[model samples]
Target: MNQKLNIAICSYRSATFGGGQGIFVFELSKALNHLGHHVDVISGPPYPKLENNIQLIKSPGLDLFSTFNFKERLKIFLGKKNKSSDDWYEFISALFGGFPELKTFGNRAKTLLDESSYDIVIDNQSLSYGMINIQKNLPLIEIIHHPITKDYQYDIQFSKGVIQKISKWRWFSFLKMQKKVSQNLKVISTPSHNSKNDIAKDFGVLEKNISVIPNGIDHASFTPILDIRRVPAQIITTASADVPLKGLDFTLYAVARLKEDFPQLKLVIIGASRPGGHTERLIKRLQIDQNILYRSNLTRHEIAVEYAKSNVAIVSSLYEGFGFPAGEAMSCAIPLIATDVASIPEITQSYAELIPAKNSNAIELAIRKIFASPETYQLRAEAGRTHIIQNFDWQKIAKLYEDLIYKTIDEFQC
Candidate 1:
């Protein structure tokens, strides 16, 4: 066993219900702690729900996105004592429609981390200038879960007009800082080969400097419930309906097309759709409102049960650094149909029925094939469960991280 080292993990925002980053931080910290390391998660607003043993150090910034009320934001911004320049910069930048949380969080994180003693600092995708400064002073390993440039590209591709494209560009303006900061980092980590390559291309980082350590799934929580009978013609997918990058719109279109053959077909989305949003309008336009259900704020057990009740799971992401929903579905032993996009293929291996992304016809055909041969698909689903248990389990993942951390510390000391 390696020497037990104190570790600090930094995240800009880590709301468990928020998105992939939050879940990653929460789960990874838990696994690291289970391996006998003393881990502390330092995060900004919308703090992560960590286990009792893990310490959480709050380093909040402006938290502009927390509320829409301008007056409330002003009060919080002005009323806070000993506010750093980073706080003012975050508020002012966000006030003008730029995402500055990464920079602000990085600035605050450097000061907080400098005061603490740790073997290594793990920056969980908060690619900011301050991270570069911290790396110069400490042993730092940055996780770049694919570059934000991909999101910007997808948004630009899906924009309705020139004005919307410009708006999208402005909202993602922080990519410039991320790209610049990433270049100087000594060591970087990513979840998949796809992400590693994308990061190299988009962030201009050397491929040799990046390490691939796949994320793990909690098999105990996501395993299949034997008592639940699978509902025929029911499909499950996790997505943010309003986000074009999630490809929920494509999934909705595919579900509409599938209804022509299987009229009893229903799609259950494990995510929320914004009221009066693009997804809401599309659901109305397709007339598939009656055939679909949206669910959110579900516990892991509840999500596993949802998987147990469904006949098929779909990952409709246009791109993913690592698809958590796909992994969760596989852990539950559900037949998965995922698009051959980004890291889905790398994660699912040969277990899933692959389809081309952004193509409704391909999605429809794949679903029809699965329904036609339920027994075969069921066997494949079981294989998926086995694959996850054998390869993507948290214990195995944590060991890999442990090895990497030890190796990094050794090389740094020499």
Candidate 2:
């Protein structure tokens, strides 16, 4: 057996409710721990829900996004002691719409980590300036799930006016720090080749500096529950947030188009849609309000059961660093219809009914075809399930990371 190593996974703001980063940290830590290694997840607010064996070092931040009430947030911000003076920067940056969590959390994590020892550290998409210093002491690998430039492009394209475009740019201004910090790092990793390529091009990092390590699917938890009767015309899809990036708007449009033909349809979304947001308004406008159900903060087993209950699943993402929902749905033995964009095709390995992105008509047609041919869909579902179980074992992924860790440490010592 290889020597057991200590690891720290840094996530500035883990998605405790409905996002991918938290799940990545939880699964990675659990898998590494299972490999006879000690793993600690160092995070800011909204931390991940890891298993009991894993340690969570809570490095709390201002959590500026916790509320919209200005006065309440102001009090919290004012009360924070100016230890490193990044608190002021966090306050001002967030005041003008810029996100400072990455920079602030990195400062806190650096101090906390300096008081301890770790063989290596993995920054989970928080490409903050502080990480460069952390790597100076301990071998560090930064994970940029994908370049934020893609999001910026979408923002510029979707903005309604000059003011909106400027506001969007301000919110994402942190990308400057990300790009600068990423360039100084010796190693970087991403979940898919699509992301690897984008990170190289956008962050100006050489392609040689990036490693592609696909995320592991916990197929053991997301197994087929044969006892649960599949509900007819019951559809399952995941849109973790109401952002345009997830392409929920297209999915909603497809559901609206399918409503007339499939009146019995019930689209169960695995995440929440913002109240009074575009999604809610669109649901009302399309008059398909009655057909949608939202289920969030579900455990892995719970999500699996939901997948098993569904007759079909959909992944209508415009882009994904990795399509976790697509793989998870397949793991549950559910037939999937996903957009062939970014890493969706690569991640699913063409085990899905692939369609072009941003086309509601294609999504509608794909769903119709799946329902039209049950025997064929069933075969595809089983094949997808088999592929996920064989390919995305977390244990195998941990071993890959272990090899990378060994090589990095060897280079650091030399």
Candidate 3:
């Protein structure tokens, strides 16, 4: 048996419900722990929900985003008289439209981690300068889920106004630091070949230095719950509103147009929308507001229940390092339709129906096809569950990670 390693996984802010990054940290730590390694997830707020066996080290920093009101945020800046200089730096940077979490997280986490010795450290996408300093003491591996260059380009291309465009430019300036820090790292891990290629090109890293490891699915939590009766002509998708990368705008158009064919058709979104945001306005404009339902802050079991009740699933993402929703939906034996973009196709094209990106007609047409041939699509859906089980089992992925950790350690020693 190989010697078990003590690993610390770093994530700046891990919202357990909102995004994939938090779930990635939570699930990866759990999987690694199942293989006998000790895992400590070092994260800032909104913290990840981890199992009892795994340790959660609260990452110390000024978590500006969590303070919902501006008054409380102002207190964070004014209240701490003895605060470190980095606190002011973090707040001021964020005030100027820059994302300072990762940079600040590295500064705070390095000192916290140095108190304890670990054989290896796994950074979940915060390739900040402080990580470079921490790597001097321990072997480090970066899991760049995908390059942020895609997000940056998308934001610039889809800016709503001149002021918004300028704000976005400042917000993503951290990409420069990420690019600089990534180039010198000896080993890196990414979810797919598409992401690996993008990282290499954008960050100027060598292809050989990066490993392509697929994200795993928990079969137990996401299996098909056939006991639940499926709803008629209902569709499900996971997307955030007003985010061009998520392509929620196109999804709304599809759902609105879809109502003409199936007047009783329903659509459930597994994400939150700001009450007065662009999505709300779009819903009103389309006059199909009654046809849509929004569900957020759901547990894994609850999400599976929603999947079991739905007739089909659509993924309208313009880009994804790994399309978790598609995999989770397929695991639950619901037929999937995802855009043919980036790593979505890399993992899902085998089992899912691929459609051209940003096309509402494609989404509407695919939904029609699935409903048209229920018997054939049902067979495909069941087959999808098997495919997810065989290809993306957690244990198999854990073993790969275990091997990678050992390899990183060996190379570090040499």
Taking all chains together, each candidate's TM-score versus the true structure is: 0.97, 0.97, 0.97
Q: How close is candidate 3 to the true structure, as a TM-score?
A: 0.97
Best model per lDDT: 1
Clashing pairs in 2: none
Instruction: Decide which is better by lDDT, 2 or 3.
Output: 3
lDDT of 1 by residue, 285-390 (tens): 9999888988898888999989988999999889999989999999999999999999999989999998889988788888888899999999999999999999
RMSD of each: 1.4, 1.4, 1.3
Give, for candidate 3, the lowest lDDT window spanning 10 residues: 60-69
**Candidate 2 — which residues are off by over 4 angstroms?**
81-84
Per-residue lDDT of candidate 3, residues 1-414 (tens digit): 299889999998888898898888888999999999999999987798999999999976778877657788888778767788778888888777789998999888888878778999999999988899888888999989998999998888888999999999999999999999999788899999999999999999999999989999887899889799989978899987677798888878988988988888889999998889888999999998888989999999999999999999999999999989989999999999999999987777578899999899898889889999978888888898898899888889989988999999998898
- lDDT per residue as tens, model 2, 1-414: 279998999999887656888888988999999999989999998878898988899986888788767897798887777545777888788888889999999888899888778999989988998898898898998888899888888878877799989999999998999999999998888889999988888889999889988899989899999899989899999986557777888888988989898998999999977888778998999999999999987888999989988988999888888878999999998999999999988878768899998899998998899889978988988998899888889999988888888888888788
Considering summed lDDT, which 10 consecutive residues are worst modelled in model 1?
60-69
Q: Between 2 and 3, whose TM-score is larger?
A: 3
